[model samples]
Target chain A: MKGLIVKDLLLIKENWKQLLIFVLIFIVIGLEGNQILTFVPVFLSLMVLLSTFSYDDYNKWNSYAVTLPNGRKNIVRAKYIASICLSAFAILFTYLLITISGMMNHHLNLEETAVTLLGCWSAVVLLQSFMYPLIFKVGLEKGRIFLFVFFIGVSALLGLVFQNIKISLPVEVISFLNHYLVIILPFVMIILLYISYKISEKIVQKKEF
Target chain B: MNAIEIKGLVKKYDDKFQLGKLDLTIPKGVIVGLIGENGAGKTTLLKAILNIIHIDSGTIKINGEDNKKEEKKENIGVVLDNMFFPEILTAKDIELAMRGMFKKWDTQVYYNYLKEFELPLDKPIKALSKGMRKKLEIITALSHHPDILILDEATSGLDPVVRNEILDIFLNFIQDENHTIILSTHITSDLEHVADKIVFIDQGKIVLDQDRDELIDHYGILKCDPSQMEQVKKEDYLCYKKNKYDVEFLVADRDKTRKKYPNSVVDKVTLEELMLLMIKGVK
Candidate 1:
């Protein structure tokens, strides 16, 4: 697993210039007082980690990975670990950037920032939960298209649900669900992510190079 | 114990092609050449031995342990026809990656091989020529001191000079008595120079498996006309091919056949000729 992680880090390092550009772009946006855009850095990190799969596909690295010791299961586990590590890094970097920008601008609300970051993290977890199993089952190319469609469907459903709540649900009931959702969503996403990893393992185990 | 023991290995790929029940043993300390034409199940057999592909029904043992177990793979090194390194990585990065992956990886040996092969350490893999990439792959495969090296067409695209150099490295690799190699290629002449044993597969079946010397020295292709061929006993030959002008028989024992058919032209066989006759000739 350490070997797989090191390889992925090296792969990401190859595209460091692009990553740096993303960081600069996020910092500029944060300086502009766009609090919501703070999540973009974490999202970019996720995209970068996912791009490693495209690299693996082009190089046929999975075939080579299976030839190494502790290959199959470790390879899958390494992806998950790397994803978490990069997300942590991205979150820390963005948090520092936003905090500094907020101090200078005097417009940042700490509690609101915490809630938004938590929401972003949960969204990422849920996205990965759906994305990984798809990638493991079909592969990176087809999985990317499926992921796009998945996100569109999810957005449309959320939009419909919000519209229904605005039209039909009373303010007290809506606020009650919203108040608890921030606390409960992370736990639910964690459980779903765990299940996703297990599913990925099963899909990868039966896969042929 | 054999380096690799495969029994009843079967892999089906749709209706037209299937690797039927097959059995093979690769003894330690010898270079076993797997010869086959394109789409002849050579890669499939190698993949089965490595457990890269799931078998339908069979058992593959590597050094007496089940091949499916990840621990058994630690003893094996593999080089597939296509290069598997990310183009963005340098040879140095590969060394770092491999050091973490293989417990016995020798960084010294890896660098030594890179220097010997004239592979640029800092250059990205995509910048290297085809032969250089092949050399890098071979270096990685050998640096860990794997007991069994399985190569599937590892030398197909290289020039003869480079191929000869790689073959020399293979020859040196098997110098350790515990080390073995399974080289799969259509380049029979390369096998003629280095291989100890030859196994030929055609249409997903093993047509011939014999000691290299035995196949070259003992096996004979007897060329004769119909009347002369009639004079030779049918049971003396394994298989025969006939044309309008002459008849060719693949005889197992050249000395015996030569002595028995004193008047017939009994010539020693080449691995290429043997493969062709076995695959194309009637049984």
Candidate 2:
């Protein structure tokens, strides 16, 4: 498992220049007051994590990988571990960039930044929770195409639900939920990540190369 | 104990291709060359042994344990054709990754091999030529000090000099009486240089498995005139190919066939001739 993680990390490092360019472009956008750019780096990091799969597939590495000791299990586990690590780096790096941008613009709202960071992190991680199992089940190329269509369908369904329903919550209930959401969301994401890991493990266990 | 044992192995790729209901046992401390044409199930058989692909109904044992056991994989090294690390990775990175992957990965041994082969440690695999990449894969497999090496087309696509260098390494590896190797290739001459045994597969089934010396010394190709073809007994030749000018027979017992047909031409059968006759010749 450790070896697999090291391999992915090394692959990412090989593309460090590309990643650095992305970071710089996103930082410039963030400095220009495009707060939405905060989420871009994390999303980019996930894409980087996913690109490793393409690399493996290109070389048919997975077929060779399974011949190694504990390969099937370790390969799956390592991707998730490396993902979490990449997510952590992106979160921290984005936070630092936002801080610099905020201070320069005389709008250093640390509390708001923290909330946005949490929401962005959760969104990206949750997206992966849905993506990893599909990737494991089908494959990276097919999985990405499937995910694009799946998400579009999901967004349309959710849009329809919200457009038809108009329910206003009480101020007290809204405040209560918002107050506890920061604490609740992390646990929820953790559980989702665990479930996603389990599904991936199951897929890998039955997978032929 | 045999190094590997397969019983009733069957892998169905589709309606057109399937491997086995096959049985094979390879004893320890010898090089077994697996010879077959493309799509002949050589790769499939090796994949089945490595448990890279799930078998339909079979049991593969390596060193007396199920091939699926993690411990059994620890001592086996493999170089599957066109399958390896991502080309973006350098040899140094591979060493680091393999260190954690294999419990017995020897960095010293790996570096020694790289130095001996003149493989640059810092160059990404993509930058290296085909021969260099192959050498890297081979040394990576060897660095772990595996008891058994299973290679699929490991020597293909290289110049003769590079192939010779790699074959020499394989020969040196087998000097350890505890080591075993199963090399699958269509390059029969490579096997002729190092293999102790040859196992030929045709159309997904093993057609021949015998000691190399026994095969080379005993097998012969007898060429005879069309008029003299009647004198050649069907039982004497394993297979025969009839042409306009002469009738060629693949006889398994060269000395016996020569004694039987003293006036006929009986030449030594190379591995290539043996495979060609066995697959392309008539029964």
Which tens-of-lDDT digit does each residue in A1-209 have in candidate 2?
A: 78889999899899899878877888789887678787887888899999998898889888988999988888889999999998888889888888898889988888888888899889988989999989888888999999999999999998998899977899998998889999899899999999999999998888887
State what share of the real interface contacts each candidate retains. 0.75, 0.84
- What C-alpha lDDT, on a 0 to 100 scale, does residue B175 get in candidate 2? 94
For candidate 1, write residues B211-245 as lDDT tens digits. Answer: 99999889999999977767778799988888789
User: In candidate 1, what are the lDDT values of residues A1-209, reduced to their tens digit?
Assistant: 78889999999999999878877887888887788696897788789888898889888899889888878898899999999898888888878877888888987787777778877888788888889889877889999899899889989999998988876779998899788988887789879989999999998899998
Per-residue lDDT tens digits for candidate 2, residues B161-268, read: 999999999999999988999999999999999999999999889999899999888999999998998999999999988878998899999999999899999999
Error of 1 at B239 (Å): 1.8
The DockQ values of the predictions, listed in order, are: 0.78, 0.81
lDDT of 2 at B96: 92
lDDT of each: 0.88, 0.92
Ten-residue stretch with the least lDDT total in model 1 chain A: A107-116
For model 2, the stretches where C-alpha displacement exceeds 4 angstroms are: A25-34, A100-106, A161-176
